[model samples]
Target chain A: MATLKQVAAHAEVSVQTVSNALNAPHRLRADTLERVNRSIELLNYRPNRNARSLRTSAVELIGYCVPNWPHQTHLVMDQFLHALCAAAERTGRHILLFTAPPGVDGMPTYDDLHARRMVDGFVLSQTETHDPRHGWLKDEGIPFVSFGRVWKESTQPGPWVDVDGATGSAIAVRHLYDTGRRRIAFLGWPKSSGLAEDRVAGWRTACKELGLPTNGMAVRCREDSIEEGALATARLLDSGRDLDGIVALSDVLALGALRELTARGIVPGRDVGVVGYDDSPLAEVVSPGLTSLRQPMDRIAEELITILTGDQQPAERLLLPELVIRGSSAPG
Target chain B: MATLKQVAAHAEVSVQTVSNALNAPHRLRADTLERVNRSIELLNYRPNRNARSLRTSAVELIGYCVPNWPHQTHLVMDQFLHALCAAAERTGRHILLFTAPPGVDGMPTYDDLHARRMVDGFVLSQTETHDPRHGWLKDEGIPFVSFGRVWKESTQPGPWVDVDGATGSAIAVRHLYDTGRRRIAFLGWPKSSGLAEDRVAGWRTACKELGLPTNGMAVRCREDSIEEGALATARLLDSGRDLDGIVALSDVLALGALRELTARGIVPGRDVGVVGYDDSPLAEVVSPGLTSLRQPMDRIAEELITILTGDQQPAERLLLPELVIRGSSAPG
Candidate 1:
C-alpha cells in the first residue's frame, strides 16, 4: 500500500523520479534508479497498474466469465478452462475468472468489466442462439472470441473457435460401423440445443451415407446426465428396435449406456459397440476403456487466444475432433 | 469508455453534477438526476470501478492462482474450483484465476498482483512445507486464506480450511474391514507430500486398531497417474504380499489398481475390495462404481471465502470427509 510519495521520501527523490525508476529506468541515472528501487523494496511499494494502464492502454489480463450453474458440474468446460489457462500462460497472458451475475441479463457485468479496464477482452464459452453477449460485444467493439459459435443465420457472429461436433459424431458412428456394427443408435439431448442438433445431424448424415435406417434409431434424453442416458437407452431397448451399436453425444451419456448394457447382462464391446464423445480422462480409466471423440482442446484454446489478441479481423474456426479407439468400440 | 465530461456535456450539466449523479444521487434534485441518468444511458457511459476503488479501498475480487501442469490434469482441483466459484458468488465475490509462473520463484507474480491492487486477497491451495507464498503474503500484510494447511512445524500458519484426510482413510479402511477383508495394503504417492503422509498414517492407524499387519503393507507410487498406479500395484502383487483390500490415495490410482486386478483375473469387489479418495464424478461412472472418500468441497470453499472476506483472524477449520460406498467395495 506504500505510495510513490512514500517511496520517493524514503529515497530522497521526487515523485516523478520514483515513477521513472519504476516505469522508465532509462530516464534516471543508474545510481538514482538503484536507490529508488532499494527504497521501493524496503517500503514494499507497489505501483498501481490500473492507474498506469489508463495512460498506457495495455492490460495483461483476459477475462472469462463462467456461468455458475449450481446443480451441474461442467466437466468439459473444466477441461477447456484448464487448457485455456495453460495456453494463455504460454502466450504471456493471464486468465481472470469471474461469475456473471445471475438472471436474464448478465451482459451488464461484461460491459462493466470492460469499461473499468479490468480485462483486455473476454473468452466467451457455451454460446447459444441469439446470445445477447455476441451482439453486445460486437456493438461495443470489445475484443472477444467465443468457444462456441452463435446462430448460423446471424450476420455478425464475430470471431469464434468451436469444435466440429457434427464431424465428431460422424467419426464416432463411422468407427462403430467399421467395427462391423450395422444398427447404430444415437443418444443425445433434446433438439433445443444447437450443439446437440448439429451432433444429431451428423448421426443422421452418417447413417444415410452408410445406408443404415435412420428412423427409430435416434432417441432424445432430457439432459446429458448419466441417469438420463441410462433411462433413454433403456427405453430404446424396450422399444424392441434392434441395436448393435451406440454412439452417445457425450461421454456421460455413453457411460450410462455402458452401465445399462451391464445391467442387462450384455458385454459392452462384444455385444454392443459403444462410443462416447469428448475423450475426457474418464474415457481411458473406465472398465472397457470408452472409445471417444477427442476434441482438440489445446488447439481450440490456442486459436481462440490467437485470434482474440492477434488481429481485429472477424475470423471463424471450426476444428475437427479426432477419434480415439479404446476397448468399448473395438470389435469383439 | 465515455468519460463523465461527455455525459455532463450531453446532459447540459457540470462535471460535479454528473459525479454526484453517479456516486451520490441524493445530492441532486430528482429531475436533474433523471436527466443525467438518461444522458449516461444514451451515451453508454460506464464509471470505472477500479479508479473509484482507488479512493474507497474496497475490492470485489478474490485471487486464486492455479498451477498449469500440462501432463497431468488436476481433476479434483477442477471440481473444487467450480464449487469455489459458486460459493464465492453467494457471498458477492468473484474469483480471478491466474497461473503461477513456473519454477521456484513464482512468488513474484503473487507479490506483483497484490501490490498492483489487482485483487483484494488470495485463496491458496495445496500448501507445502516452507511455502514462500505464506511468508510473502504475511510479510506484505496481505489478506489470504489457504484451502489446505501448511506444515505442522511452521510457527505462523494462516487461516486454512482443510478436510481431514486421515479420517477419510480410516473410514475407507474400516469399510473394507467390515466387508471381511483381513489383509489390506495402501497405495500412496511418494512420502514427500504432507497430505499423502496423513492418508498413509490413517491407513496405518486403522491397521493397528484392527490388529492387522501394518509393516510391509504400504507401497509408494512415483506419481498419481493411472499408469504409475498400475505399475505400483503390479509391483506390490509381484512382491508376494497377501493383499485382499486396497486403499488408494486417489481414484486414479485405485482405477489403475482395478485394471491390474482384472488383468490378473482377480475380480475387484468379490476378490479384493478397493477404495479411492476424492470421489470425483468419475467414481460413479466407472465399472463397479468406485467406493471413495468424498471431500466436503462446498463447505471447504464456503468457509474459505467467509474467513477470507470476513475477518483477518487466523482461523483454521478441519472438516471430515465422508466415505461413499459403491459396488467396488461392497461385500462379496
Candidate 2:
C-alpha cells in the first residue's frame, strides 16, 4: 500500500536510500539501512519487486505482441498462445502480452520494450516477407524467434517455426479428389501474402497433376474473415461456376462458405463438400463437421520456446499439418 | 544492449551513480554525471525505460491474469481481451498479460509482479466464490477490478463488472415458454460455481412461476466442454424424458446438444428448440443458427478500464444480457 517515496519520507531519507536498502543493502550505511527498515515495517511498505528485479537483472519475462484488431477472431492464435505459455512455464519463464500499436509502419514499441529490458525476448507471430521486425531485431542483436518466416530472397536466416501450408492444402485437394470431387475450388486471400500464395500454389499444383481445371476456379478476398468468406463464396456461386468441392484457406472462410451453401438450399457434405484449414473447435460443432487441416500448435510453441531460450539451434522448422476428416467432406 | 553495470564500469563509477545520472541528475555530483553521460554515449547504452519510469513513478501498465489450461478454449475470454485492450488504449494505458502458475493454490506470481511494480494494478477474471485471488489482493490492498463477482453473502465487494446471468437465463426461459414450449430442460455445470447456480436459479424461478415441473429436467456436468455437452444430451435423450426445449448454460453445450439432436434425427428448431448463452461468433455459423444470450463484452471492458483508471467509483456494475433469437429456437 505504501510507496518507496512514502517510506523515504517516513524514514527522513532519500528514495534511493530506501530502494537500496531493499535491493542492495550492502550499498547503504548500517544506520541508514536500519532506519529504512524501521520505516518500511511501520508503513507496511511492500518493496517494489520490479525495482529489485531491475537492479539484479532477474526479470525472466518473454513478450508476444498481438495486433490491435478488435474485429478479428484469432482462434488459432489463441490456442498457440495457450501452448506457448505452457512451454514458457516449463522453462521457468513467463509471457507478457502487449498490443502492436495500430498504423505503425515498423514496431517502435518493440524497440522501446527491448531498450527498457522489459522482456528478455519476443515471440513474433504472423511474420511477413518484408517484416521490419526481422531487420530491427537482427540489427539490435536482440534475442527473438518468429512464429513465421521472412521472404525467401531476404537471406536473413532466423529461428522460426511455421506450418507447411502447401502440404496442408495439397492434402485437402487430394482428399477431395479421392472423394470423386472433380470441380474443386480454392478460396484464399489476395496475392502478396506469402502464406496464402503457398496455399493457392498447392491447389494449382494438385489441379495440374490431376488434369483438373485451375483457371477461373481460384478466388481471393481482401481479408481472412467469415464475412469476407461468405461474400467471396456468394460471388463464386453467382459467377455460374459449378463447383463440387471447396478448399478454404482458413476455417473462418469454410464456415462462411457453408453458411452461403446452406442459404442456397445446398447441403454441404452431399451437394458441395467443404474443407477448411486450422481444425478449430468450431469445425466439429457445425452440422456435418468440417474436414480440416490441424496445425501442430503445441509443437510449434515448443519449438519457438526451445529456440528463444537457447536450447536449440536457430533454424527454420516447418511442421506438416494433419488432415482431420469430418462429415463435411464425406462422399455423397 | 549495454546494461547499467556496463555503463558504470566504463565510467569508473557505481551502478547507482549511472542510474542517478539518467533519472535524478541533481542527486549526483556534476563531475560524476558528466563522466556517466560520456560513458553512456561511448557505449551506446540506452537507459532502461522501466528503471527511469520506476524513479519517476510513472508505469502506466495494467495487468490481466489468464489461466494456463490448454484443454479449455477461452472463446469468450479472447473476445473480452480484445475489447479490454481497446478500452485500455482509450485511456492511454496498456495491458500486460501474465499466466496464473498452474497447480498453485495462491497467485504467488501476482504477488511477485506487484512487489516488483511490474504493473499499476490488475484486471482479474473468473472470480469464484472462494477465489484465493480475492483474499490475497484485498489483504494486500492491491488495486484490481474483477470481471466477475464473489458470492452474494461475502459482502466484501471492491470493484467488479459482471453480466446478469439470472436475467439472461430468465429471458431464454421466457422466450421458450412464449414459443409454446412446456417441457423446457436446463443443462448446467455441477454445483459449486456461483455464476452457474445463478443461471440455474433463473431456470427454476421461471419454472415455478409457470407452474411447470422442475425436478426431473435439471441436469449437471463435470465440465463446460462440447464433448461433455454431447454426452449429457445423449444421456437426456436416452432417458426418454420427453423434453421439447432446452436452455444450455453455454454455447459450447448448446452446440453439443444440437450435434446430438441432429445425430438422432431430431431436428432442433422443428422438434426441440435450443438456446445457448454467450452468443459466440460460432453460434451464427452452425446450421439452424443458435438463439443465444449476448453478453456486452465491450461495455464490460469499458467499465473495467474506467474503474481501474480511477475515473469511476468502486462499485459493482451488472450489465443486462440481450437475447438474440435465431432459427434454432424458431417455432415449428
Kindly report the fnat of each predicted structure, to 2 decimals: 0.30, 0.20
Per-residue lDDT tens digits for candidate 1, residues B110-207, read: 76566545567899986766676777677767789988777655564678898999988888889999999999999998888888999999999999
Candidate 1 backbone overlaps, count: 0
What lDDT would each prediction earn against the true structure? Answer: 0.80, 0.79
Give TM-scores of the second chain, every candidate.
0.79, 0.78
Q: Which residue pairs in candidate 2 collide?
A: A48-B115, A49-B115, A49-B116, A50-B116
Model 1 chain A worst lDDT window (10 residues): A50-59
Task: Please state the CAPRI-style docking class of candidate 1.
Answer: incorrect
By TM-score, how accurate is candidate 2? Answer: 0.63
Would candidate 2 be rated incorrect, acceptable, medium or high by CAPRI criteria?
incorrect
TM-score of each: 0.65, 0.63
